[model samples]
Target: MAKVAIVMGSDSDMPIMKKAAEFLDQMGIDFEMTIISAHREPDIFFEWAKGAKDRGVKVIIAGAGKAAHLPGMCAALFPMPVIGIPMKTSDLGGVDSLYSIVQMPSGIPVATVAINGGLNAGILAAKILATSDEKLLEKLEAYSEEMKQSVVEKAEKLDKVGYKDYE
Candidate 1:
């Protein structure tokens, strides 16, 4: 039973969506990933979204370009946190997808990330789950510390080498 479901409308989204999977994996979060187009195959998509909760999926990270309905649809049917990753499209550079996701109507809400922000979507889902799990929350804290340490190290190196000579 996966705690997270990472779905995308097209396989083309795999590159961006996989960042979410990788981050989830790093956080020791179990996740199931799949490609299901809401437009081309509404029946399958509907079934998957409707049954996700029953299948033990607590969070959904949906990536889609263009109209980007996958995340909103999951929000409508799953009754859980749905994070949307707006893919960069050739047409409008993903502004269309981003708007479609971020501008949800009253009740139904899909928490959206920046364009191609797969890693952030995964982190957000983990944080949402952490709210109920102390162990997970501790892990998230450690993760934050690691990130802070990384930046500190980089800043130290920049200070030592100076910005002009820093790698």
Candidate 2:
């Protein structure tokens, strides 16, 4: 199975992007991370995408805000899947980033998550990899069950004490 590659447009996005790294770590998925800006470091982005397949990378998780082109660029250059996380910037609250990521050309598609939704991007990447990995599939199933149990437990607490009282 191919490992995931986590790329961000800037170091400023690391705070949001770290959630994806944490998720990958928890799920025991191997990943590589780097800051490769599509605008500032175009050559590096192209090089990374061109060699990603040979480097055994199966998916790419890219996070950027405003004119977010990293994900789309990577997807266009690489055959593997690319998950885009739109970071919530100060100006447009990340709507600009979302549109840039989601409005790909007909041939290229970047799977995009909500603004500042790096966690979901990580989980989706796990899901994509799990299609060909039995171990990852098992882990994902367990994770889903755990999430369900957590919600149920929270609801039970809310019922016993009432929502306001619990808080």
Q: What RMSD value applies to candidate 1?
A: 0.7
Worst 10 residues of 1 by lDDT: 71-80
**All candidates: TM-score:** 0.98, 0.96
What is candidate 1's CA lDDT for residue 6? Answer: 96
Candidate 1 per-residue lDDT, tens place, 51-159, comes to 9999999999999999999889999999889999999999999999999999999999999999999999999999999999999999999999999999999999998
Please report how far candidate 2 places residue 143 from its true position, in Å: 0.6
Off by over 4 Å in 1: none
Candidate 2: 10-residue stretch with minimal lDDT: 36-45
Cα misplacement distance, residue 145 of candidate 2 (Å): 0.7
Off by over 4 Å in 2: none
Q: Write the per-residue lDDT of candidate 2 for residues 1-167, one digit (tens) a residue.
A: 44999999899999888999999999999999999888987887899889999999999999988999889989999998999998898999899999999999998999999999989999999999999999999999999999999999999999999967996
lDDT of 2 at 120: 95
